[model samples]
Target: MPTPVILEDLQAAFPGWCIWRSSAGRLWATRNGRHLSQHEVDHGLCRTIDADDVAQLAEQLKEQETAEQAL
Candidate 1:
């Protein structure tokens, strides 16, 4: 799949996140509205997550989703 399609899929898969690619080609995602708390951050949540490719970004997003659910 193409980058744009992958980005769209990611955006759809993680509705609470805004996903995009930088000019330098790094994939990034940030939460749409609410911010993570310090406790969440300390427990491994992040304000923003970046990955070199779609798969890694997806995996990270899934992990974040799990972390959010655990809260």
Candidate 2:
């Protein structure tokens, strides 16, 4: 079997979610929990990344690649 995936691995792979800063120096799940930069979030790096978000991002990347190749 392949190496198992972990949360840190997901976090590293998706640095977009790393932009969030908590008062306690940790990640957050919502805006009230921590102040997230509007820019990063709009830029697709809000740091509120969840598993579903990751999967969606992967799908988007795949679609973008397919479109680029078709171009």
Candidate 3:
């Protein structure tokens, strides 16, 4: 499972997505109001990543959110 800090950061960054870990220790995500699976995100969106990459994504998302809010 991801640490609390990483989990909180991701949740805040991706408010419209569901991010979680599976029992097998794999990360998964699904957009809110969508029936997409982790596999779909990986193959279709080409967003397969590890924990470190997730942190980077969180930072990017945070910046985008901030910019959107400022506009």
TM-scores across all candidates? 0.89, 0.31, 0.44
Clashing residue pairs for model 1: none
lDDT of 2 at 11: 43
Candidate 2 residue 41 Cα shift, in angstroms, is 21
Q: Whole-model lDDT, candidate 2?
A: 0.40
lDDT scores of the candidates, listed in order: 0.87, 0.40, 0.54
Q: Model 1: residues >4 Å from true position, as ranges?
A: 1-5
User: Which has the greatest TM-score?
Assistant: 1
Candidate 3 has an lDDT of 0.54
Question: Deviation in angstroms for 16 in model 1?
Answer: 0.4
Residues 1-71, candidate 2: write the lDDT tens digits: 12214445434543433423356644333222546456544545332432234344444433433443454
Model 2 worst lDDT window (10 residues): 45-54
| Best-first order by TM-score | 1, 3, 2
Off by over 4 Å in 3: 1-5, 35-53, 56-71
- Model 1 agreement with the true structure over 1-71: per-residue lDDT tens digits: 33334888989888999999999999999999978789999888988999999989998998898988888
Query: After best superposition, candidate 3 residue 38: deviation in angstroms?
Result: 17
Window of ten residues with lowest summed lDDT in model 1: 1-10
